[model samples]
Target: MTMKESERGDGGPGNGRPDTGADERPAEPAGLRGLAALLRPRVSRGQLAGGVLCLLLGFAVVAQVESTGRDTTFATARQDELVGILSDLGQRSERLRGDLRELEETRAELERDAEGETALEEARERAATYGLLAGTVPAEGPGIEMVVGDPGGGVKAINLLDALEELRDAGAEVVQVNNVRAGVDTYFLDGPGGILADGEPLTAPYRFLAIGDPHTMTTALNIPGGLVKTLQGAGASVLINPRAKVTVGAIRSP
Candidate 1:
């Protein structure tokens, strides 16, 4: 028979040999075939989503608890800090009140103590005092209260400053605008929602309380080129009320 036409032998090559019962073949994975029929399929990408959500929820709860712990839990470090702050403020306020009372008492005693003392009486009578005693002297006079405010809600910082300056130049002492104490470092308005003097918020309907020569202060503030005029241009009224006693207390800035 021609070599090309001959049937290929099953033995290792074209050599003629009977196939052995132990002929080698790759072994099948022992458990895969059986397990494949019984087991579920591999998890898809979306299957991990639920697990991730559970993990994230745990983290979120931790964060919320930490954030709100101060309000929710007492006896914590945060609570102690707040308590200390409040206590300090209270103590300071009380001390100020006590000092003020003592000062007033001292003043009262000084006035009454010198009534009959010959040496003191001679000194007092001899010393020419320009102003009258504050508490004993009745302050009877006409005064003005010019209210400065921003009703248009578009007033500028410079505008308010100009008004206050005009009032001051008009000889306004103890000016209070919009609940703000106009002190040395006091600000009137950087504008609405802004701070003018000493970080005090300048809001609408600013009430300027001034204690000075009432008529003079009023005239000065109400002058054509004065604060009242400037404020009126911005649609704000500068109404002055004359009062006998206008108390201006020392107001602190934040």
Candidate 2:
């Protein structure tokens, strides 16, 4: 027997298994040491991927939150604006209601008066019963005359109409501008201040007469916010006189 053969048969230095067992030990990581060794290759890749995924998720959440907040802010601002507008409208409506109530009260008071018949009624009665001539009647009364001139002092017809409106509000029964009588269908044009009553040209200083109570007619001429003041401000001369007697040669109301 040789020395090598004797040592191998007795297996004096190692187990019967060969040194190949040492290679198999590294294939699987069991304990802490094994785990550390096994992690070396994959640790870097895992950390990088996880970090990126977290960042993406965080960004998405932040964007969603910002969008929701912006939408809410816009909605709130719109609501506030609408509320402010409604409040302003409500105030205006209340004021208009108060004015309407006052007008109703005034109208009711007027309706209760028995002697408030118009001058036309008296004329009609006199013509039918007393055989009085319509055109030969001499009239004396109170009234307002409105002179409308252009904003440039050019005397535009529209300004005259503005004055006519004031006269109507003042309760004039007979309004004549230049030589034209004012009627429901009376109008004015833009050219030199001239009145058009049923399409007839009438002339200036537009004299108006009222057959009603003298004091009452005067009120229309001099009342606050009346057409006289407005026309005067527009560079037009408005003269209102309380007449003792106004002669109308053949003036008749159609």
Estimate the lDDT of model 1.
0.65
lDDT of 1 at 173: 50
Best by TM-score: 1
Per-residue alpha-carbon lDDT of model 1 for 181-209, expressed as tens digits? Answer: 66555554463455565566766566666
> Which residue segments of model 1 deviate by more than 4 Å?
1-142, 189-192
**Model 2 TM-score (2 dp):** 0.37
Instruction: Kindly list the per-residue Cα lDDT of model 2 for residues 102-219, writing each as its tens digit.
Output: 9999888787553456556777877743321222233444433333333355455666676667555655555555565555666776434444544666554445554344566667
Top model number, lDDT: 1
TM-score of each: 0.41, 0.37
Q: Residue 147 of model 1: what lDDT? A: 63
lDDT of 2 at 130: 31
Model 1 clashing-pair count:
4
